[model samples]
Target: MARIRVLTALKIKRNLKPGMYADGLGLYLKVRPGNSKSWIFRYRTGGKLRDMGLGPFHTVSLAEAREKAEVCRVMRLKGLDPLNERLKEQQAKTIEAIETITFEKCAEGYIAAHKAGWKNGKHADQWTATLQTYVYPVFKDKPVAAIDDTLVLKVLQPIWRDKTETASRLRGRIERILDWARVMKYRAGENPARWKGHLDHLLPKRSKVAAIVHHPALPIDETPGFFQILRQEATVVARAFEFCILNATRTNEAMGMRWDEYDEQAQLWTVPGVRMKAGRDHRVPLAQRSQRILAQMQEIRTGQFVFPGGVQERPLSSMAFLMLLRRLERKDITAHGFRSTFRDWAAERTDFSNEVVEMALAHTISNKVEAAYRRGDLFDKRRQLAEAWAAFCAGTAPSKP
Candidate 1:
């Protein structure tokens, strides 16, 4: 007869390494790297050896592991495989976890698991923000399995028409979160938040219901006049704005510009894919005015960013342009609208092809066939267009029609 209780609680704590230590009767303590320990039941069923995990050392005590091993020994005597029985027990626990998990809990888990793969920090933040602001208010503590179509509709209808774009994005985000829940086994049925074949029948199509509102832009003729005043402001943000307009780039792109990205001799500014909306590198051909702006910025250059913010060692705040606009009493127009202004001027004044103009603005072509056919960035044509645009913004008549 084998002696029972061969292992004591003190001995379990003393033996710590990266191999299995046997207690007796096929019960072993597996110690791994980082001092992590767990209990395992090692047995031979038929001709194969099977190792079944009990629980972690911190959770399952020596006494408990012995009791579980005794149970497994009895099952083996009855001609039952302990490994198969352990899997069945795990399945039961997984079912319990699925039933008890709340929608918010599942959402948090999903974000934590996937946010690292997102393009930028802002996108990850947007995922959490939308879910918390809109979805959480409705299903704060509800189990994901209990979420239904009516509850989802209740979250969307209030903002569906008034804040159409935000509401649409929110709906899509909720659908993704619910889909994740189903994949995680927290929910079993078809996603209630799904737009196609489900919510499509309930709410009006977004395109039909939501009114499209373009950002307010300066008229083609007014750009020169606005810049004349803007040039005299003598502020870092003002110069940043001028550089942004001259390059036909976004506010964040201009604010986040770095000195190393500029090639003085080549006269090009390469915006990295991380900072771009399309997640691809964009090469901006610097016009004379753009280079001049860089020359002016060189005198005050202090940190990594070409235009440093009010705080130390950070890029300029995105709101700097908007605040500057407000101070200039141009609340009607947005900094982003300058891109549209450039587009309008290019279409109205220049003989340049739409492709060249769109490329200058770094606009992604929505038509797949058109995008596939377009290979080059048309750098030379865009350079000509940029120089002409700079001239127009500086109150000079374009040399080309």
Candidate 2:
């Protein structure tokens, strides 16, 4: 063999230009102008010249570089391209691995895919707020695949007991995102956020958790008088609040109501699947008074929403309805509590069945066995019930069936 040309440390320090140099035995030095030095392997693959960076000199010593280079030489001799082989290995590790994806990246993708399908625009805002508050801080920098049960529990346990309803929803949302990650191969195995049989055994049931404080509601008898005063209160927000009570829907659902959702001909207003609380479509039988309110709203329907805010293309704020209630000197009542008023009134003052009343208010009936057996929405019976409710709210005697 010819005399060996070894690379001494002194020679590496002297030639510190940013390039690679052959130092016999397939080892080479990649020198940078800043005196930073790394090692590379020079080899021929199919009569082609190629270079592969091994690592920094500090991390990979001269001996180690030579050992790695010998492996590359053998691979080349066996007709394998070292660079192509290394790339293939890297690609394999990246596929379907949570270690490669960040929480922020997955969150953005989750929001994009599901935002439009949300029941209301505020649903999207709520999802973003929960992630920002709980999930983002913990996993923003972490790879999605690395998130485990312990990590998920850390974000959930703090609020799970105190804010059970919201916490339960947040848990479901978290499971959805992790499921998306798994489907995309950014994560693997069963979802860490699963609840039904998995997390259920670990955490207390949501119903067992302490209830959150809500604004106390006015008695049912006081609602019609409250509505009368609310009608005279001249503001888009006040009118929207009155409509919300009359329709017995949620504040956001009413304020976010669109002109297209109305059917003046059919005397119905159908909240689309994306906007209903149950994520199912709801049909509201439009009473004559509700139709009159819609007609009045048409005069101000300059935009898509019935109650457009001052800002362009924005719906009225949730607080706006509450403020109107306050201005009417009914601070004791809540916008959501009006639904309770309607439920009480329907139960006490009418002959409508519990299912009809529950479905009318878009409340999910919890009796799974009963729900599975019952296919019909009892729309006709509910229409008759709604007519009776309308008469009661309008200060008229109940209509004869």
Candidate 3:
């Protein structure tokens, strides 16, 4: 039997306790111990009992609860669970809505998934360091969905002028993480880090930023004295630096030098395309001094790399050369500046063409027309240049050779 529907005016004065009072039409008043009353509907779907809350007593009057109950009763009769259907609808709405996933979380997930694909562990560390230093402090707590152009500008604008190269990489990384978040349903919309039509106008071109000034090379006359001082240092790093200068190669290329890359018979060091900066195989014509250094390194070689670090298996760190230079009190000259020194000596002292000099340094000349026509490596000209430079370092000339 169903009870008569009591008007709110009577129920408000009566102060009902925690229990359900049938109010007819499948609607009932559920009162709490605190005397708060809410409207609920009791019904069955596929022999299963279900209770659905309609509204609070104060919000929905007895008349309104009755109307809502009739709708639920109809829904129940149609083979639907009113409670289950309501929950499903809520979940669907949640899926469509954008929510905040912090930048820190997104970056962590990104690094964990993609670190293995990086060329080296240092590459992974570099990516993490940039985000930790520049991006995380600005957007760590902020939801990825809430980040906009204004927030992104705050991160980039400070270093955009001074550290353009690093800032450029940071911008690309930010865009990648946001794109990943969107694909994972954490956020959705256009990527704010995009530079094409958006940030291009707002910021100066990265190329236009002031070029980083490195320590200039010592004058050509100072080469003999510098080489003499470098030779006095007995560390493997000093030997490596000497080898780098003799070959005119970058520090990274030298650090990762492998014994297998050398061919004693061919008298050449073949740096693989993966290790070369231009991503092409580079053949360095071995000078007399370079050959001597390799022969000396063979006594210590226990693994793949010629200049293995203290750990035995790994290559010497890129900083190893710089630290050695600092110890010699010649920190004014950079390890890379030796290439400039070699170039200066070649241009001022030798009769070799610019192509020969550039080839010796393993630099890619960008003149497309000339590059297309000039396929030969000028190996004979380079051999003469390398021998001449080695002679200059040894304080002798070709007349003596």
The candidate scoring highest on lDDT is 1
Better of 2 and 3 by TM-score: 2
Residue 320 lDDT in candidate 2: 91
Candidate of highest TM-score: 1
Candidate 2 per-residue C-alpha lDDT over 1-401 given as tens digits, one digit per residue, 9 for 90 to 100? 63344787668658466877777877888888887999888777567787789999888877788889889888878878889999998887767454778877887898899887665667778888988988888887788888889988988999888778778888998899989888877888988899987899889987678655765776877666766776777778877877787788987789889999998899888887767778888898877778888888898778899889988888897689777766767777788987888888887877777888898898887889987898877788777877777777777766644
lDDT tens string, model 3, 1-401?
64556545576547777898877766778889989888889876567766789999879877788889888878877877879889999987776454646878888888888887665678778888898899888988888788899999999999999889889999999998888888878887898998998889889898798586665787888888888888888778888988888888888889898988999888999888777777788888888788988988998788999988988789898788878878888768888888888899887877777888998887887998988898888887787787888778766653221
Which regions in candidate 3 have their CA more than 4 angstroms from the true location?
A: 1-99, 161-166, 179-190, 205-211, 364-381, 396-401
Report every candidate's CA lDDT: 0.89, 0.81, 0.83
Off by over 4 Å in 2: 1-73, 76-100, 122-128, 163-166, 212-215, 298-305, 311-315, 365-377
Once fitted onto the true fold, the runs of candidate 1 whose alpha carbons sit more than 4 angstroms away are: 1-86, 117-125
- Give the per-residue lDDT digits (tens) of candidate 1, residues 1-401: 86556777887788477988888899998999887899999999889899989899999999999999999999999999988887898899998877888988888888888888776678878888888888898997898898999899999999998888998998888888888988876788888888889899999998888878888899999999999999999999999999999988988889999999999999999999888888899999999989988998888888888999989889889799999999999999999999999999999888988889889888899999998998899998889988999999999988673
Per-model C-alpha RMSD: 5.8, 8.1, 10.3
Rank order (by lDDT, best first):
1, 3, 2
